[model samples]
Target: MTSVWVGERVRLRAKEPDDWEAFHSFEEDSDAVRNGWRLHPPSSAAYAKKRTAEEAEQRPDLDDPDLVIATRDGNVPVGSIGAHHSDRDHGTFAYGISVGTPYHRKGYASEAIVLLLRYMFFERRFQKAEAWVYSSNDASLALHRRLGFVEEGRRRRSHYANGRYDDEVLFGMTIEEFTALHT
Candidate 1:
């Protein structure tokens, strides 16, 4: 049977200990880091390897650990995606995705997101999914819209990056809406 985590061009898989180099490469993209929730100093190779080991150790117990986004044909790691701020009581959740600098605009992010949404809404019984995007990140903003997520709200000047503040745009989609569009 086809896997739920498998998509057209990308597949979401458990992060492996050997995936440290790909994770570390993502950190090197200054724009990606700045557009993300927080900006931090550069990560060393040792730190990345350590983090990968920790994630691998934690994966079995976690319902939705950060997953590696890899090319379907060769299984080459390109990025990562993860669910966050999950509220099982309310059937709501949020997620974040990051594609490496070299892999941008290749449709890998889109397919990975669809796979995650399908798993969350269908298998996990989440009613709604939300994503927070920085205003500075135009690509992400467009991607959410293209995927049929509605703009629910925005927090004004809530995120600081690149010597300035950017609004955090909140986008949401319900299970019904996802079914309508993706099914």
Candidate 2:
């Protein structure tokens, strides 16, 4: 499937080479770092490699193809959403997402997420979509809850960030749930 998903206010677009600067900026932001679970710097070369592999997949789960969440009008990059550990054979996926520091509370991440989930379940035939949110991330927790994700489990002290361990909250939404929520 194509990597362009249009939403009311945001669009999840394919990661183009031109988007590197915006993506790098989002990754390097100090505030984003504090809330983000993964702290490592993203390399431009690695991003390109991932894109190449994604395009080469014969049966690509569009959700596994990392995309930039940009405004629908000017297409300004604001965030990212990607599925990793995607087990298409089992129809399951685990995803990660973020919106830039300046774009928080604007409903961009939520819009991007719902579009991606729709692509995952309806187009890619995914049975379920899952996420691991850092327990301290109130915004993400609330976003998942508002998007109809069910809290599945918790791994206590599983993530180390900001010189302390944080719990990882597991959330999942099955295809039936996705259909019910959307339809």
Model 1 lDDT tens row, 1-183: 899889889989888899998878778778788877676888788899998988887734244557889999999999889998889899999999988989999999999999999989988889999999999899999999999999999999999888999999999999999999998
The TM-score, computed over Cα atoms with residue i paired to residue i, of candidate 2 is 0.84
What overall lDDT goes with each candidate model? 0.89, 0.81
- Top candidate, metric lDDT: 1
| Best by the TM-score measure | 1
Shift of residue 81 alpha carbon in model 1, Å: 0.8
Worst 10 residues of 2 by lDDT: 52-61
- Candidate 2's residue-wise lDDT over 1-183, tens digit each? 444389778988766666666666776676577677667755676775565455434353454777778998899989888888889689999889988898999989988888888888878888999999989899999999998999999999998877888899999999999888875
Instruction: Please report how far candidate 1 places residue 128 from its true position, in Å.
Output: 0.2
